[model samples]
Target: MTSHNRRKVRLITALAVGTSLLGLAACSSGLTAAPSDSSAMSSPKAGGNLRVGIVGGSAKDSLDAHSPVTHPDQARVIQLYDTLVSYDNDHKVQMALADKVTPSADATTWTVHLRAGLKFSDGKPITAEDVLFTFKRITDPASPMATATSLATLKRDEMTAPDAQTAVFTFSAPFATFPDIAAQYAAGIVPTGYDPKKPVSSGPFVLESFSPGQQSVFVKNPNYWRAGQPYLDKVTIIDFPDDTARVNALLGGQVDAIDQLPLGQVNVVKANPAIKVLESSTGSWLPFTMRVDQEPFNDPKVRQAFRLIVDRKQMVDQVLGGHGTVGNDMYAPLDACYPNNVPQRNQDIAKAKSLLAEAGKSNLSVDLVTSSAAAGLVESAQVFAEQAKAAGVTVNVKKVDPGEFYGDQYLKRTFSQDFWFTRDYLPQTSNSGFANSPYNETHWDDKAWSDLVAKAQATTDEAARCDLIKAAQEIEFDRGGYIIWGFPNSVDAHSASVNGLTPDKSGIPLTSYGFRNAWLAQ
Candidate 1:
């Protein structure tokens, strides 16, 4: 046997001793409802068109299911296409279109079984060939999809559709967390002859009309795989780039609900009583990213000094309006494998100065690029600038337009701030912390960290994987480039007329933008 096969055999033998194999089977059910006090709410009655106002959209919006760059895009795509699996309010993997996904003994291969009698919006059968085609399209080099980085280890040549109901995928290494990957929003399935302009829906809604940066109208999919779902006859996602306009639309009854409710307007909307606010505690964070490959940050001491200069509690109180928990310079606070034992990092101005002095960079001054991209990003940057003065460091806060902030210089900026929703440890790291992560703003690439993640991914035992993940997290704690100050609560608002909207830990408002379950009260 090859060395990789030999290693897999040994791992299987060792894991079999006391741990069950990593074969997870999700029930063939629709999305689960988030925990809510629905005792007094009236039963859902179908037929009205639900309009939702969301922040952030531009002329660059797209209908591509594999890549959704903005809130509106994500909201629309999830309604238009279906992935094999999805996450519930607690961020647990739940089966969507697939009946069950099973892994091999060594976790190097995964077999997917589609739910029988599934059909697209056009009444075409959803076979295993469609699943294989979607994955191949995602990994195609000629046109790289957004989920390509996450599925980099997928062996394209080894993928096969054994029959109409079964599709098998082989990976280069043991991917015990393949289920989580399959649950990604960007991994939505598409038919073989898929055309972006004339999209086929495997989800609750079918696109009727789409105008980038303005609105997307979708009618209910009568053939949706889920039974008795999509209570609304239509869903209209309207993009309001300005927060004020979005909230006003909701209050003015122009829209049924709004996502990303500004912190300042939470009480204003609550006082009306005509609207109800939905709040979900999440692992989401807006972090200051320091590029480690560049000067000033290239030195480990400089990076540590920057991390030590932040007052996390103050950031949480002032910027988040006391709506979040303090962070410890790490992401994925809700991950099962999060290293809770790691000491919380508190601001130490004296130590920060000493570290800067040792790096021969005392009285350091750096421009902190920020924007009003999200609710608290610019405010946090301003707060951090004031706090850095205690360490004798000058943080020059430079505010930019939201559009320009995410433009060409987004990841290239020396020091900037960015936002992220709640994600588990491995998936979160794959997008932002790994060497080839497309959004690796810090440019942190460490072999030790990478190896630890690989081992954790291969390990089947939950406890063993947790141990490996903790070890990797410790390395990041010492030298990672992100100054994660706090995790803000996801806040959304909806008209009292709207029901079925529940809190979700995934950090996406309106139950991870789940419009399928929502219905308007007559």
Candidate 2:
């Protein structure tokens, strides 16, 4: 057995034994304790409106909770609606609207039990019927939402709400990790007749006013389920598309917090004792996507040559400003199933040249499309262009506007860049790994790889699922079109007076922009 397999065996054994101890602790406490983070130090005091500065927003932003396309949209959605489940600081799944979610023995069916007395901001009781409605709209064939990809296996016709508080979902195939999917940021629950124009929230806050690309204002939800939560009277999220203005907003005391702090400004911000910077290690990445079906990259040797030509270490150090770890041409470094045992791929100029020559492209030139949409994309592309010169390759870096980059030519580009937040292996793959993936920028499509992913998703046993996932990862490591060079840290900042902002591995800054727990210290 490999070291990865051995680790899985030990983990399963430990989980089996730990269940008894967990039961004992629950019995003693009369409830299962929620996971806690030690990063939050002081007690919270309430009653101040918090203003947060977020990066990147355009007029294309929408109030639709299910299809948030910008950082500001995502931040607003989290406040206006609650997902069934969410990731805590450590990236473990935790209950939100649903108190408990139980899977059937075969992992094909799931039952969700909502917390008693839950109500929408408008005072209507939150019910399973609403949950069913929300999901139905999300998976509607004619107009599916962003989360439809994650729920592709869901058997929409078999869904049922047998009681006001209980919802049942049946899938076309076994889905052992439904909770993780439920925790997606875009999977916010809504009412039966929900309207984006006039929203009813089940979350800690209710939308008061919004302006696309400008700002959004929210008021505390009086009917919020969590006790004494959403301590603030209001929240205001302002969009500062420019990094300099965003950082300045915090320094000037115009905003209480800011998300996606520029790596170049980390030292400058840290030097200010009045400000507190929270840094969390994340699985987030910005990869150079090479279309497998296109010229130059269509040949396996050419793909291999490009992969070897990248100086992963140099990119991580210079492009990320030493705020990240090197990537080995694979994603989901934080996932348990990630094949860490695979030998790390590094720059080999001689080998890259040889491979290029073998592919009859001894002197190759390619256009690398990139944009300033995300924080390090353009710089990474430029750095990579410089590094490719060592392997007899002339890389032409083409910078496009953020809006134009993700516009009509998004997935159609033969070579481009894309950004992703930290997600587990299966969910991440569902978005970008398959033939029909909505964001499959690389255009990678292989039956063998897809079959392995399907088997892994269907496997109820954790160890067996991980084994299948490792095998799939190995295939991608060998021939995948992504040149994943690094995983950057999520750096966010807030005023010293702000409490409850802690490090979160979700890669969304400020604990997935969870201002519900944040309060102004007196």
Candidate 3:
């Protein structure tokens, strides 16, 4: 057996200490009747359909994991497919369908071995062909997925499968984050010739039915590779684009849980004695991007002036309700490579006015477009416009429907509100949001900054890599398109009876790391 298999064998062996293969029981209902004993409550019993609601759902939701744009679409991808690798609750890499991921000495080559006897939901063996196909599809230029840009370093020609169980990747240069890239939802593994709309999942659950802008249902996968898992028999994901409606669903017990709990309604949930509130720090941020290619914002001093006038603390306190940390322009907090030493940018209207004067724009009227796509986003924009008045600028606020924000308003406007979900890898976050990335909404392209990011990616030494990343972040902090004001903690609410739900800041709450591990209390 290979080293990866050996490690998995050891883990399975450790688990064998308590229960035999047949000792694990199965259930067929949404909730099974637990024994009268209180001890039964502490242990997970198989059974129950979990009904979950999420914010920001629309008819445009994509079943294709590689191209999902909204929060609900992202959450559904996690339920319907498994990545080559995945992260644990603490954001550490953990083996999933992939039994092992070994990198070469220079980090240019990576070898992936799938677990033995792995099978898709349709009972076909999951092999190297599937893994390679996933990479090729994600990197395809025509693909609308953000991952196409995120995995740009990967070359299709260098990807090969030596055997049915083994997949190999050879990069032109050292790319230490290949594993991180592989683990992302966009790179989720699917069977060869798999169809996104009617996907056959190898994950803990199988998609039963889907209704656009309505709800999607998933039933447990009995043949799932992970034994004795997915205690819940089914998961019903309901769409609620409106915050009040979503929260009301949870409060009325119509749904067991809700994702993206609005900060304004957090107190309302808290008041309910039967609701369990869970919060976790996330790298998620709400930022206003200024298109440097635009007229007034084309001037660097004006951009700097705009950044200086915003009160980040006030936004964090009033908008986030103190459930978040102040952001310093660049994204990726809670990750190891985040540049913590960069001096915090505080509100300075006098300095901003001086910068505006230097830019020959001492008097300016700017239109700030915003949406309610994320909580506090529109409010933050309004507060920022008020704050900029002290810098001798008139800021106009234009509101659009949250649904149309990402599709129409964002990137199309010279200045607009955008929110990014937390990505575990700092380099991935930087590549997706900054460093000449296609998603770099600000259109701030700097060769020197890109060079620094390249160096950081190629560096093998942790300390050296961190230094390079820090330098790149410092450049963005000084003059990037994003004015990151707050890193909000991901907050979710579930019924008091819902068990095993953990806070996840890696993006979508409750489901990003697989909600199959959760069960409804009996």
Candidate 4:
């Protein structure tokens, strides 16, 4: 291999390890609530037409509680469905069907008390039975919720209800982050034995109709428990298949709000007087995934070598248009558990070459697989390939249908490198996304790293957990499960007249349309 290619290989290896350990030290690990900007959330307007945008078709393919694998159609379903608990714009967990939460003295068990009077969109009193049913189906052994890991650690048989309005959970272990799991979409509620295809829920909006790949309408639920809420009477969600198309739709006044904007043009909307931007930090980063079971990647030295070559700051500046923070190779600096003093890799070509030589190989060539929808990943992949070539490694960059990119064909097939966007607290991220065998699809297993993660999670001591998490991140970055580039400040832009839009607590856009509390200014 040329000296240039060898240099890049070394960078890939070193940076991958260096960043994971120290990257998150600067990250904000504390939970942030949704922005309560007066312009976005205040008093309710009661009723109006709220038009929104969807990036792709809202996957109306199924509404069964078993479905909801994507976010496209969730806004439609959120109008009709309700989890036992919900989060207000501020990200604070609030009682939904349940009134109060009381955990047993040991904290391993939690009893949820339901609000007295509530009804599903179908007018059925949303009793505790419905909540139990919804929980059971998703947690059933026959079902493997794509998003299961978010709520997987719980023991299913441990959930019981004393009566209709109250359910109790006895855990197999004490988990400090239990409540956080309840707020995810996969835990959405449906009636017992309800067909997984047709869903029923208790929330502010109801799915009126869906036209595949076009638009879906959600009508306000008059019986919604949130009084004086769901300000708008109807929400028309238009699907914009192309990124520019969505922006164009917003500019043309055909839609009032859109969730996505190309990274370069975020400034365009900021410059426009008509739009408002809301953004927050997230535990998400562009990951260069190496299935450790495969050749070259299976060898830690090779993986670490390639990882070292990545220039995190450069990737952030070039690919994200300078709106994001440079990734340090782990999850994000926001993860409290990330270490304060782990090694950070610098782009040193000689070091990369030496590492590759140590791995008993000289020539390195591989196909870099990327998804079509991940424009950022594709652009970054090209940059990575170009940089690796300079380090004496030839990278064949290939774009594949994103639909199948994460499936068995890509996960278990011929692809060598893949891009993955990860979201969640740092510790959970380390265990599920990077750890192997039962949780990690990449199958990377390290005894010491796993032990650190376990201690961090089981303890309620925030400071200790943070320290442990930081150590685990070190292991991940140094060992070469991934090379995280950075975290970008993600925001959604909308017409200024489309007042009352803010970033949600989780760094996602506020897409649900019953924002009767939000209205267009005259």
Output the worst ten-in-a-row residue range by lDDT, candidate 1. 1-10
lDDT of 3 at 12: 7
Residue lDDT tens for model 2, 364-414: 989989876678888899998898888888989998865567556777788
Q: Against the true structure, what is each candidate's TM-score? A: 0.91, 0.92, 0.89, 0.83
Error of 4 at 163 (Å): 2.5
Q: In candidate 1, what are the lDDT values of residues 1-522, reduced to their tens digit? A: 000000000000011111233433232322232233232345778899999997777776777777666677778778888878776666666677886677777778888888889999999999999998999987788776766666778998789999998899999987777767677777778888899788999888999999988999999999987777788899999988788889989988999999889988988999998999999898788889999999899999999999999999999989888989999988878776788888899999999999999999998999999976677988899899999999998999998865567566867899998878877777666677777665777999999999998787778777888898889888888998888989999889999989888777877757353588788888
Residue 29 in model 1: lDDT: 24
lDDT of 1: 0.78
- Tell me the TM-score of model 4: 0.83
lDDT for model 4 comes to 0.58
Model 3 bad stretches (over 4 Å): 1-41, 424-426, 429-438
Global lDDT scores for all candidate models:
0.78, 0.78, 0.72, 0.58
Error (Å) of candidate 2 at residue 148 is: 1.4
250 Cα displacement, candidate 3 (Å): 1.3
Candidate 1: which stretches are off by over 4 Å? 1-42, 511-513
What local lDDT score does residue 309 receive in model 3, on the 0 to 100 scale? 90
Q: Ten residues in a row with the worst lDDT in model 4?
A: 1-10
- By lDDT, the better pick of 1 and 3 is 1
CA-only RMSD, every prediction: 6.3, 6.0, 9.2, 8.0
TM-score of 3: 0.89
